[model samples]
Target: MAVERNIKCVVAYDGTKYQGWQRLKNSDHTIQGKIEHVLSKMTNEKIEVMGSGRTDAGVHARWQVFNFHTRCQKSTKNMMDYMNQYLPEDIGVCQVEDVDLRFHSRFHAKKKTYIYRIWIGEYPPVFERKYVHVVTETLHLQKMKEAALLFIGEHDFQGFCSRKVKKSTVRKINHVQLKQEGHELTISVTGNGFLYNMVRIMVGTLIDIGKGTLTKETITEALDTKDRSKAGERAPAKGLILHDVSY
Candidate 1:
């Protein structure tokens, strides 16, 4: 029997055209599906790759990680080249390596960092409209920063999540950093794990707080009451990016 080797890969993709990261049964319009198609062609086997996590539709990823087991004899470098050659131009393979057979990308991930970019420029972001959320209102960074502090550390993030959780809603947020440069405002968050739409909802709440529509007390209310309605609107998916995943 040919030995099956675990192959790990890092990929970056513009998720504008794809549905999401996870593969769907009826549809092939996903990042995972596209890569799997190319990989299967190369290996001559039906391959299923395990992703570190899913990114929602219209959400981009700069350093998404996934792993799969394959019996193909190609070197890691050749596999990477083959994937890039066949995969859509929107998706790019950054690295490929042979890893331990037991290595599972999703379970092995220890931390993930996500970044949401907002443009507060006077004019619309004509050059980068697809990549950022453009906001015309003045956003008070100080207020947003103060409100952001409330999210750090462990908490039952049920209120921040948009979906009902069958599992525990508790998640640990390591840090929330906000930076502004000219017309750009970036909200970067590092967390152990996140509930569905948690980061986007948090960003939306922060934006509302900055605009004086919501107060810092709103975060406390969400944490204390576990009411999703207490949180702000979920931010648009275009602004969100999976920045990195660390094992």
Candidate 2:
């Protein structure tokens, strides 16, 4: 019998039309499902691909990684060409490489960065509507920054995560910063790991602070209490993007 080997690949996808990165029953329009379908067709076998993490519905990824085991010894370039030819226009395999048999994309990741975009203007920009969350109300960037500072360091982020998450809520947030360029506000958060909806909820709470609806003290209280209701609304999925994952 021939020895099977593992192949690792980096991918990027525009998630405007797909239902995030995970595959679900009866869902043929998810990013993972679509990729697996094409890979299965190319390999002539049922190929199960594992992603580094799942991005929520309508969320986009600039660089995401995954791995799969294969029996055939095919060239990376050939596999890349075939994947692109069969994959939908929104998803693209950026690069392919042979990896160790024991390597797992999710477990090997060192950190992940997510960016939540906010458009604060009277009229939403036509070109960026698909990527940014439009908020007509003016925002105080300084206040948002102050609130963001409270999230730095390791903490049990139960309040910032959705209740649907089953994993441990303790995550180390390496940095949280808010930047503003014109009417665009970007919240970039780097963390060791995150729970479901963590970044989006954090962005929502900061937006609330910007709008004067929430205070810096409230953020501290939310973290201390570990209560979900004390935090701001969960921002829409369309505004959240997985910027990059580092290994």
Candidate 3:
């Protein structure tokens, strides 16, 4: 009898066309569903791939970690090659390894970094339109930086999350870095875990601050009151990318 093995894989995808990362009952156009379909055929068993977390529709991922258990004896290299050969062109398998049976992709994840790109140029970024959010308003980067700093510590971000859940809304953010190069404004957030739409809301609030539409005190009030209405609107999903996942 073949031993069951935990197969870990890192994947990247241009999620422009898919219905997010999680599998759905009615839709076949999902990143997880596509990968799982290929794996099930490769392993000759019902394979269910577990992702580190779910990314909403139209959100891209540069590095997403996932794992599945299988009894197939194919080598890791062969498995990676087989998956890439069958998976769609938009989704690429970056790395594959045989992990311990106890290891889990979502449960063992220590940190995740998401990058939200904004184009603050006067002209349209034709080449990067799908990857960036174009903003025409005059933005104050210094003000945005000051507002981003307030999100570094742990807080009950009930105001930032759009979905109401029974779980605790308190989460610790390791860092929030904002960098501007020419017309590109990149906001990178590193956190242990994120709530639904939390990152987008944080970025949106910063953009509001940059435009002088919202004051920095809004962050304090939002954190204190845990009111969703206190935060800014959720940013577009296209601008958000799952940049990296750390074990």
Candidate 4:
């Protein structure tokens, strides 16, 4: 008998082509759907892969975790190799490990970090166009940094999310930071969890502040009043990358 075993996988993908991480009922062109289809074909049985969380369309991921129960007899290395060989070139299985049956990727996740990249040069980047958000205006790094600090700590982020949320908007932001190297600025945020478009909206607001379009009061009012309109623009999805999910 083929014994059921739990398998954990670390996935990395360039989200430029697909419709994000989750499966949509209407379309099968999704990351999860692609992986599931391949696995099901290889195993000759229906297979479902669960991810830590969903990444919005056009958002990339460096380390997304997922787990599933399988009866495939391939060794861990062979499993990883099989996925890499069959999966699309944009998505790759970084590693595969056998885990306890109780390991649930989403429920057991500890924290997730996301990074947004912005290009400050006037001329558009030639090669990195799809991977970064290019800002033509001069940005006030100090002002943006100050405003980003306010996002640190727990607060109600009702205004930060874009979806029709039924759950509480309160979430903890463990850290907020910005690092500039030449014309590229990387905005990194780590938190217990994130609302739909939370990171993208935050980045947009920060960019507005950097450009002197938005003020400190804007961030404060959004948090205090829980008004979505009080927040800044939601940054483009391509600039956001799932840095990692820590468990």
The TM-scores, one per candidate, come to 0.99, 0.96, 0.99, 0.98
Off by over 4 Å in 4: none
| Candidate 1 residue runs with Cα over 4 Å from true position | none
Worst 10-residue stretch by lDDT in candidate 1?
121-130
lDDT of 2 by residue, 1-247 (tens): 6678899998988899988899999899899999899888888779999999999999999888999998866789999999999898889999999989998989988899999999988876899899999999988889899889999999989988887457778899999978888988899999998888999999999988999999988778888998999999899998888888888
Root-mean-square deviation of every model: 0.7, 1.2, 0.7, 0.9
lDDT, candidates in the order shown: 0.95, 0.90, 0.95, 0.92
Task: Itemize residue pairs with steric clashes in candidate 4.
Answer: none
Model 3 TM-score, 2 decimals? 0.99
Write candidate 1's Cα lDDT for 42-126 as tens digits: 9999999999999998999999999999999899999999999999999999999999999999999999999999999689998
Error of 2 at 59 (Å): 0.5
- State in Å the error of residue 147, model 2: 0.7
List pairs with backbone clashes in candidate 1.
none
